[model samples]
Target: MTRLISALLLFALACASAAVARPNILIIVADDLGWADVGYHGSTIATPNIDRLCREGVELNRHYVSPVCTPTRIGLLTGRYWSRFGNTGPNNERCLPWETETLATALRSRGYDTCITGKWHLGSLPEWGPRQFGFTHSHGSLAGGVNPLNHFYKHGKYMKTWHRNDRLIEEEGHATDLIAREAIRYIRMERDGPFFVYVPFTAVHTPFLEEKRYLEAVKHIPDDRRFFAACLVHLDEKIGEIIKAVDDSGQRDNTLILFFSDNGGQNPSSDDSRRYPDTKPTSKFKGMNTPLRGWKVQTYEGGMRVPAFVNWPGTLKPGRSDALLSVTDWMPTLCALTGFKPTANLKWDGRNIWPMIRDPSKANRDRTLYCKGPGGRTRMVINDGWKLIEIKNGERFELYHLDDDPNEERDLFHSEPDEVDKMKRILARERKADDDARPDPKRKNPSPV
Candidate 1:
């Protein structure tokens, strides 16, 4: 009788432990995808899987990121402004200092198996790789971007291509498919406990390539754009596959999926034309920022704002929000959700949005947000609806009232000098706080190959 009681008590404890395990996290980051690229945002592109995530989850309408890829990635990983850590440029080996605490590192400490399956543009150095940053397994290109067919850098100067656990390997399949297959494989094999999978798809970026079936499906839309659209479809299917894997593994209820783009889409022609001339000179796919001006490389709304959605079976409510959240907020928000404390010594620029996720109506992010770009030449600050932009050189300080002029058509720098002054003062204070929050001085930059 006593032995039976002991066995029953042990079973109850096991069940309770399984029920309380930290939620599995899947972060799907699309490369250079515009806000309008997804069906939820009104793009003609067929993104049913992504659209479903937005429909059944919360869509962050005013989500923002850095003006370019690498900077935005740095912000996403550290939950701090990229500029604060001197990671303000593209293709810079000095960015993302080794000692910085990454999302992968934080989650891994909490007993989660962390894996990254695509683009690690933060740094190309040996120490900067995913393994050094707490990811147990990583497979993908290390540079900002890669060619689809040959899996080579555009310039052909960088020899670093595909890598799997520190060993270079030749990859034959299309990049997007390769990433998706690896992500699913990880999910299948690592379902014992909570796991974090970072799938940063190289699709819909430059040198757009797709499988023959996908390419043939969209052949009617003109070659270049058709191929681009096909890539989107391929990405959608892969997203569905990943979601299905989680559901089939009985981990769906405890899995939280976050989908977002690294930055706004590039003008396909600008990059696509250089490689493929016969392909109908790539044109804008009309991603709906409705009133935002500019594209990928600018500090305007369209460039910085991208689609952000979160879906966790029983946690987040389904809806849309314009709460002005940035990608940097994910780290702290995820930490809060999983009951993990962020590093006490580190200062993060992002605020926890978990409360907002639970109840969107109660969401209010009032902190000032900052963005810095290449050479630290481009900078911008957002506080509520007002924004201040400071470009390099002697360019005039530009101010915009985003609430009223969403397209940023009219400059209010001279019209509302007092408001601009107030914003400037606020920005000054915020900048001081950020500058003082630097990482350890002894930390060295990762070496680039």
Candidate 2:
């Protein structure tokens, strides 16, 4: 009888230790946000709440992601470069194959109640929705970007992509408001264990239709930027509500809230009318990507690098880290920090970045980061301080010492022939590995590779 009591006590203590080790994770992804789009970054946009997170959180100064949404999300969820799937465009159909272990799935296996609120462009149809990818609850658009109020994808069969779980439903609120409401509802609910909530907002991303109140508030802003700034404000306010909910649930201390833009903001283009119909002043709707070269779709610093931060009050020290980081690093880093072991399946391209996060001055100097984007036919390879960008699939190329010229303004291709060859070789090797991992391009037809 004594032995039984002692065993029971030990089991209870072990459970307590496990509970203390696991922290609730809230990852917030903003769509099409720019480098200088927030208050802390000196933008004209008023984003006090997001600015507060930046001030109180550890700024991810050198964070990089895919130049677009679908691929960025694929990397974020799988911890693998999306190019591994032989694709870089918006994944209109089911992206992840069945039985794949996503970040949510891995965390779920480790006893987390996982939920996603907002955009889930990974798969457009209900058959391949978030539930299939391990989210216990999901509410939002399955499309890349939807009309803020209408909640419809481009007029087509997949037009009605907004859903709750696997079922489509008509909701009355604006997209941003609806997403925030669902997130708050999730956070306020009672839970015995850690929760993983991924809030991927489609704000500031599309047709540029602003809510009446938000539009009125930002009336001082000029032209098309008015709607953009209003959208940003709405996004910031919603984020504040989610953070407040976490605080109300008494999970503030143990909750790690990470915020980052999925990619750089869109720039003015000739085809803007076809892409965003409701953009009021479409003439020059280029978002504020000041000081960073290029915009969405290019492999430049502006297209991939973004404003990012992680906040965990007392748990993580708030500061800035210029360490080389990518969306792929999140899964490994989160697993390491929260004591979760993902089921061994596919090998990961990302490594744990907790060390860099802990020591701001420390960097993954030896690491190589590779990216391929469809817009500019952009292919990039970076090792140490050297970066090589092969535009239009090597039709044209540029090499730069990124450590010195963070902006790819000065092309050093002719000056450093050896460095160019080195990076090209590295990109080739990584590309081959990724292509090998992907399904044969000839076999699939829906989303042509």
Query: Which one wins on lDDT?
Result: 2
Which residue ranges in model 2 land beyond 4 Å of their true spot? Answer: 1-20, 270-286, 439-449
- Cα-based lDDT for every prediction: 0.76, 0.83
Looking at model 1, residue 272 earns an lDDT score of 44
lDDT of 2 by residue, 234-258 (tens): 9999999999999998889989999
Candidate 2's displacement at residue 412, Å, is 0.1
Q: Provide TM-scores for the models.
A: 0.88, 0.91
In terms of lDDT, the poorest run of 10 residues in model 2 is 440-449
Clashes of each: 2, 0
lDDT over C-alpha atoms for residue 248 of model 2 = 90
Residue 79 C-alpha lDDT in model 2:
88
Q: How do the residues 1-449 of candidate 1 rate in per-residue lDDT, one tens digit apiece?
A: 99999999999998876544589999999887887778877776678899999999988888899878887887888888877776655663535556668888888888899999988876564455678777899988776566665666544334455778645679888788888999999999844568999999887776665668887766666653776788788889999999998888888988999999888877543564344322323334423344467778778887899988999877777988878798989988887766677547567788788777778776454767787755666678888788888777326789998888877888899999898888778766656654443444367655322
